[model samples]
Target: MKGTISHRDSFLAHIQQQLGKSSSKPASIRRPVWKHRVNWETNEGLSKEELVEQLKVQCQQIHTRVVETTPKEAPSTLRLLMKEYGEGPVMTSSDRRFAQYECHPMFQALQKEGISVTSWNADTSREENIRQAEQAKYAVVFSDYTLAESGTVVLSSHQGQGRALHFLPMMYIVCIEKSTIVPRMIHAASALHRLVEEGEQTKGAIHFISGPSNSADIEMNLVVGVHGPVRAVYVLIDDE
Candidate 1:
C-alpha cells in the first residue's frame, strides 16, 4: 500500500489548529516599539575630545593601550609603538588610508632599516597571505570605526584584508581616526543600517574586537592570547 504525505500548507494548518489560531496571515505586520532607547542615548552629548577620553578609560580596563597623535605625528607614533612591541616580522593591511594619513612612508623607512614588513597583497594566494600573517610578530590595520564605550575597534575585511590578518599575529596594532570614534555600538549599527537602506554595497566580514584575545577558565582565572594576538594597541590619530 502507498502512503500519502501531507502538503506544507496542511502541515502548517495542523500546527495552527493545535495552537488554536487561524491559519490566515495577519493583514499587516508592525514592528514593536522600544520602550527605552538607552543604547542610542548613552554618551550622546559627549564632545569628540570627551569621547576620546572615554575610549582611553575603557581601553585601560581592557588592558589595551591607547596612544593619541596628530596625523603629521602618526608615523613617529607608530614607529614608537613598533619599537615598544619589540622586533618584527611585521604585517599590515594594504589599506589606502596609510598613504592618505601620510604614514605609508614609514613602512618604506622600516624596510630600509632591515625590518621584514609585509602588506596584504590582493594578488597573492590565500595560503601565502595566511602564512605571512602567521609568521608575523605584529599586524597593523586601520579601524573603520572605534566604539568609545567598549574600547572596540571595528574592522571590515575585504580583498586586501583577510580575517586571519587580525587573529594570527602575536601583536595587533590598530590605527583609529578620532573622527571615526562613536559613542557606542549603536551609532555604528545605525550608520551601517543607513548604508544598507541607501543601497550601498557594504559586503565584508565586520569584526568588533574589544581587546587582545582573552578568556577565563571554569575556575575564573583569566588567560590572555589563547585564540588571537596577545597584545593589542590602538593608535588614535587626530585627523580632524
Candidate 2:
C-alpha cells in the first residue's frame, strides 16, 4: 500500500509542503500613501502665464485647441470658435456649468445663429437626451482642474456630468478657470481626494483627460477620436 500514493494523499502532502515553507510572520504589505500625506514639494516658481504657455504648447502637440480668454471675453471667444469650427449640432453639459454658460450672451448668440444648441441634462425623454449628445458635433463641459505639466484636464463625473459629454461628441470643449490650473496631475488628484474625503463634493468618478483620444494600435498608425472626441478644446477662463 505504501509503494504508491493515492491522489488524496498526494494533495495533502503538497499542502503540508506549502505550509512548511510559508512564513509565520504577519504580512507587511505597504499601503499606498494618500496624496494628502505625501511630503514631496513641487516647484512653485512658475507663474500662471508660464504654466498656461506650457500647457498650450503641449495641447497643440496633441491637436487640442487652447483659447485663452477672460470671463468677460469668453463669450466672444466662443462666438469666434463657433464660426471657425462651424456651428455644431451642439449638446452642452447638464452640470452646473450649463447654468454658467447659459448666462453668457454667446448662448443666445448661438441660438440666433440657427445652431442647434441643446442641453444634455434638460428635462426630456432619456433616449432623446442621449441622442442629442450622441449626434452632437460638439459637446461642452467644465473642467475641475487643468494639469499644466501634461496639458490634461480633470473632469468629475456626476449624474449631471456624464461621460457622454466628454467622449461621445465629435468635438469636446472644456471650460476651465485659470485658477484651477495645477502644476501636475498629482496635485490635482490630491485636491480632488481631499474634497471627496471632506464631503465637499460628491462624484462617481474622476477623469484625467489629455488631448483628443488617440491610439496607435492598428498597424501602429496613430488614429485620433476613435474612442473619444476627435478634437478637444480648452477655453481658459482668466477671471474665475
Candidate 3:
C-alpha cells in the first residue's frame, strides 16, 4: 500500500527545491556590529572570605553610576509601580509544582502580613483553592528568571497550576533569583533550549511580564489591565 504525502513534508520539500544550491550567495550583507562583554563578576570562584570581598567590589562597581537608595525606597517604588495600573495589595499561593521557589523569604514575609496566603498543594481542597483566587486582591508569583534589559519576569505553569494566577491578580510580586538575570533575549532562549535538550518538559505557558498591564486603545488614554497583571513587582532575591 502507498502512503499519503503529508502537507508539512510537501511544503518543506517545495521550499528546499526552491532554495537548493544557494548556500554560497550572500544576501545584501550588512556590516557586523561590535560589542564588548562586561566581566561583571569580581573574582573567579573566590574563597568564602574572598567571595565577600569580591561581592563588595562588585557592589561598588554597580553603585558607581546608580543612585544611593534604601531598601524601604525599593519596596515603595515597587508598590508605586503596581499602583500605576490601579492595583492594590497582593494575595499569594505556594504551588507545589514549584517547590524550589515556595520557600522564598518574600513569600514568608508576605504571609506574615496576613495577605491571604494559600497553597495549591495536595493538602488543599479544590473549592478552597478557587475561593482563594477569586477573593485575591492580587496574585504575586515567583519567577524562575528575569531579563534585566527589558525588566521582564518569567513564570512557568505546571500541573495543578492554573494559568489564572498570573492573570486574575490585580498586582503581581514576582521574586526573581538574581543568578538567572541575563542581558538579552538570545541568552534566555538559550537557557530554555538547554533545558529542553536535557529532556525536561517545558510547560505550555511561559510568561515574560514587563511592567503593569496596559493598553492605549481608546484615544490612547493608557488604560491598564486589558489582558493580564495590572501591576508587576520584580523582587530580586539574593540567591547567594
Candidate 4:
C-alpha cells in the first residue's frame, strides 16, 4: 500500500502521548462567532430601486455598462446593444427567459438579417457547443440573480447553459430582470439554500461574474479580458 502507514494506531497514540492528551479520541472544537455582522447588514434598508442604483454605481467601478429598459422595449434595447457591440455572430444560452421576455424573436430576426446567432443546444455534444462559443463575437445570457453590493451576476449552469458560454465569448451581455436584484450575496445564498430545503436540486455550477475578466501583472499594468470577455454589459429589464 503506497499510502497506508504501518501501525497507524500506534503512530497516532505516540503523537497523542506527545501532546499530553490522556484520551485517544480527538477533542471536539467549538466554532467561533464573530462580533460583526456587517455583510448581512450592509444593504439592509435599501428598496428595490435603491438596490438597482447601487448595482449601477458598482458597475461603473468594475468597468461594466448598465442599461435600463422596460420589458416591452427589451428586444429593441438588445438590438441596439448588439449593433453597438458589432452585430453577431452571437452565442446565447438556451435560457427560457429569452422566449418569456419575448427576445427570442429578435434573435431569429437578426439571423434573417444575416447576423449569425447561435443558441446553446442541449442535444449537441460539448465540443460542438465550445466550437460555437469560440467563434462568437458576443454571448448573451439571462442572469439568475444580480448582487447589488458587488455588481455581480449569478449564473447557475445546467444542461442548457454551460461554463464555457460565459468565458469564451469576446463580449458578454447579461440580461437582468429588475426583480432579481438583491442586496448582497447573502440573500442569493439564502435563496439557493431554500431551494435545497424545498427538495429542489440546484445546478452543479454557479458562477459569480463581477465584470469582464481583468488582471494585473508584477509590473502592475492592468489588463482586461485576460481570461474572459473583453467587454461586459448588463441590460436591466423592468419586468416587475
Candidate 5:
C-alpha cells in the first residue's frame, strides 16, 4: 500500500513539473500579414497567358526574352534555338529536370548534329567544370521559382549547381518549372522561411536574377554581360 502511494505521488509531481515547465516557456508569437496583393490574384494560380503577360513586362525591363512552350515541345524548341546559335559549346548543370532529355531522341539528334554539349558531373572537379562553362556560349540552369510581379527568378545553388554557373556563360537559359511560379517576391520569401522551418537542406547561394548583366558605370555605354550573361532566355515549362 505504501509503495503504491509513493509511486502515485511521484507521478503526480512529475506531471506538475511538466505543466510548470510548459507554462514557463514563452508562447508562440503570431505575425500579422503586411501586404499581399500584386498585379494578379495572390491566392489563385496564374494561367500561361497571365504568366506570359506578366513575364514579358518584367523581362523587357531587363533585356531578357521569354520563351513560352509546353513540356512536350520544350526539348525540341531548345534544340532549334541552339541550332540558331550555330557551332558553340553548351554547358548545363546536372539538375534532375534536364536529365530526362539525356535519353530522349530530340537531345540525341542534337549530339548527332555535332552540338558540343557538356554537363557538370559528380566525378569531375567543379572549378575545372566552371572554367569550361566560362568558355561556352550558353549555360542552361534550372530556375527554382519566378516572381511574377518583379520579373525576377530565384535560383538557389547547391553542390550540383554552383554560383559560377550563374555568371560565367555569355548566354543563360533559365528553365523554370511552371508550378513553382509565385505572384511576388514575398511569396518566394515565405517559401524560403517555410523551408528553413521544416529543416530542409537549403542552398548555399540564392540568386534572384532579374535580367541579363547590365552596367551604366562606364560612360553610360550600357554594356551587357560586363558582369554576367549578356543575354538571358527564360524557358517556361508549362506541362513539365
Candidate 6:
C-alpha cells in the first residue's frame, strides 16, 4: 500500500513539473487576425463594368510608366515590348507551316531563338523552380487568380512554383485569365482561406505582386530591382 501511494505521488509530481514547465514557456507566435470584406461588395457604389474600366485605365497608366521609365538606353517601345513578351516564329501544327504571331504563341519562338523555356509541371519541385527563376531572364506563369484593382497576381507558392519564382527574376510575366480577376484583396484572401480549410495543405507564404520592384530610397533617386523584379508584365486574356 505504501509503495502504491509513493508511485502515485511521483506520477502526480511529474505531471505538475510538466505543467509548470509549460506555464513558464513563452506563448507561440500567431498569425495576425484580420477582418476581411469582399472588395467589390464593399465598393457597392461602383458597378462591375465601371470597376473593370477603372482597373484597365489604372493598369494602362502603370504599364506606360514602366515602359517610359526604362532608360531610353533600351530600344524602341514596340521592339522592347515584343522582346519582353516573347520571341518565336508562330507555327500551327494543323496548318503544317510557320507563321508570324506575337504573345503567348510566341513563347515557342522564344525557345527557337535559343532562350530557355521551362514548363512548370503540377508536381515540380520547389527548389528547382527557384534555381531556374534565378537564372532565367523571364518566366511566363499561368496564375490561379488576379486582383484587378491592385494589379496583383495570386500564386499558391506550392509544388513546382515557389514564391521566389514571383520575385527573384529580373522580369516576371504572368498570364491572368480574365475571369479570375477579382476587384480586391479580400476576395483573394477568402479564396485562399477556403482552399486551406479544404485541406489543401498549402505552404505558409502568399505573395501579392502589384508591379515592378523599385525604390526611391537611394538619394531619392528611383532604382529598379531594389528588392524584387525590375519589371512585371501581366497579360490579361479573355475568360473564353
lDDT of each: 0.91, 0.79, 0.55, 0.91, 0.77, 0.57
Please count the clashing residue pairs in each candidate, in the order shown.
0, 0, 0, 0, 0, 3
Q: What does candidate 6's lDDT look like per residue over 17-133, in tens digits? A: 978754343476777655763444665455555655655666664541222212221223323554755552211111111111133344554567776666544455656656766
Q: Look at candidate 5 and give me any clashing residue pairs.
A: none
In angstroms, how far off is 32's CA in candidate 3? 16
Ten contiguous residues with the weakest lDDT in model 4: 23-32
lDDT of 5 by residue, 1-240 (tens): 454445876677688797875434347778865575553356348675686578778888888888878777778778767776555678787788776544246656757888767776657787788887888888888787888767798988777777888888888888877877877877787889899889998778788988888889988888877888888888888853
- RMSD in angstroms, candidate 2? 8.2
Please report, as a residue range, the 10-residue window in candidate 5 with the lowest summed lDDT: 35-44
TM-score for each model: 0.86, 0.77, 0.56, 0.85, 0.77, 0.61
Instruction: Name the candidate that leads on TM-score.
Output: 1
4 against 5, candidate with superior TM-score: 4
Candidate 6 or 3, higher lDDT: 6
- Using alpha carbons, what is the TM-score of model 5? 0.77
True lDDT of residue 228, candidate 6 = 78
Error of 1 at 199 (Å): 2.7
- Output the worst ten-in-a-row residue range by lDDT, candidate 2: 36-45
Candidate 1 accuracy as TM-score: 0.86
Local accuracy of candidate 4 as per-residue lDDT tens digits, 1-240: 478669988888888899998754548767568799887889888999999999999999999999999988988998999888777698999988888889888988999999889888989999999999999999999998899999999998888998999999999999999999999999898888888879988788899999999999748988999988999999999988
